[model samples]
Target: MLRLSAQHLHELAQYAGDHGVRVVTENWFALLDRPAEVLHLLEALDGEVGLLLDFGNWTGERKYADLAQIARLAESTHAKANYDADGNLQTADYAHCLKICADAGFQGPHSLIFDSAGDEWTEIAKLRDFVLAAL
Candidate 1:
């Protein structure tokens, strides 16, 4: 994520019109909670610096913060992950997260995450297919 912030993000936004990666995903809670600060940084960005709402990475306090601020910047998103003891997805209201994005006017081929451990690609792909199928 740091490689993205210091280099890719600003550059991608700057060169958005030229790249197919016109949108980006970022850790939601990592950005400032104050609306002004968030808006200021985002406004400084090129069109490419969109939101990628991660369900699993927020502070417990911020977890319940209303979606208004983050939702404003979303174009695409990620559901991250919430798995059980068996590595199956936890029974959380994932649909509510999707609703938040939808209400914010994002139309996403949103990602669903699995293990962020080793060889995450195969698991991510599998989860992605599953989430797609479920949706």
Candidate 2:
């Protein structure tokens, strides 16, 4: 149960603002796994926070729907991908994921996040290119 209190988040947001940086969070924690929780936090912070939507991060039922609900608030994206034995993306639908972000008007940076064997850079490059082209 990864958690960050609203007060702590507000303090961090203020600190980041003072330093000329924006604070963002990812849905990589149980506390942030739900759309309502994320929205509530953003509202509590007066929308001073940014969200980093991660593809293929949230699993279980209605994954895409949940993602879309959060994507609308996305300031950035973690374009994570899964590759097959032949080094091809197989786990998730990149186009579907990208489309959701696009529909939500997310035009920020797409950071590649893929953990696999073989050439890391090569896999990253492949995902990067795919995301870029998709965007």
Candidate 3:
């Protein structure tokens, strides 16, 4: 399955490139949940496609390390913010993720992601402020 996906992605990337469009994939798919798989796909593509790292995609104890492993390959990022029931930001984790990307020399654009139930603009502003401070 991974091989097949990689082949398809490579072809798609070629097609997109012909139209002057760059192809990028995120680490959100179940098939690409692991760092090795993501790396393999990128290797198969041979720089034809770039990665859009998502902060909230991979979870658990290895999340940070996993993200660090591929941070350098990212063309952009989905800076997804998590919040508690009380609406407090998960500062330590988020900041650490941002720091990892920054340390890896990731200078790409960060697309803020906030999905909590509230005024989206306000939540986005809060997230933006936190990201600014962290970076």
Candidate 4:
């Protein structure tokens, strides 16, 4: 199944490349969630596709380690943040994730991801500020 998925991604990436579009995958998918799986897929694709690492994905004890392993491969990132109803940032987790990416030399744009119930622009701005500070 992993091989099949990799093959399909390779084909899609090739097609997108032909039209000058870069193909990137996020860590949200279950099949590609593990560090080893992600590395395997990248190897199968010959590093042709870029990774858009999502900070919110891959929960559990090894989340940080898994993210650190793949951080250097990311061309871009989804800086997803969890917020309380009152709009308080979960500083530790977000900051740690940012640190992991930074330590891995991930020099890429962090596209903010916030879906808390509040004023959209305000929340986005808050997230952006937090990310900048953390980075």
Stretches > 4 Å off in candidate 2: 1-4, 84-87
On TM-score, the candidate that comes out on top is 3
Assess every candidate by TM-score.
0.61, 0.88, 0.95, 0.93
Task: Write model 3 residue lDDT over 15-109, tens digit each, in one string.
Answer: 99999999999987598998999999889889998999999999899999999999999999999988888988889989998998999999999
In the range 1-135, model 1's lDDT, one tens digit per residue, is: 344453656876667757655656565455544444455556666454766666665544545354556776766566766666666655454555655666677666676666545467777776676566545
Q: How does residue 43 of candidate 3 score in lDDT?
A: 94
* Candidate 1 vs. true structure, TM-score: 0.61
Best lDDT among the predictions, by candidate number: 3
By TM-score rank, best first, the candidates go 3, 4, 2, 1
Writing each residue's lDDT as its tens digit, candidate 2 over 1-135 gives 223567888889899999999999887657887888888887887877788898867876777899999998898988887667877786357788898999988888888888877788888888877877877
The whole-model C-alpha lDDT of candidate 2 against the native structure comes to 0.81
**What is the lDDT of every predicted structure here?**
0.60, 0.81, 0.92, 0.87
Which ten-residue region of model 3 has the weakest summed lDDT? 81-90
Cα-based RMSD of the predictions, in order? 4.9, 2.2, 1.0, 1.3
Q: Sum up the clashes in candidate 1.
A: 0
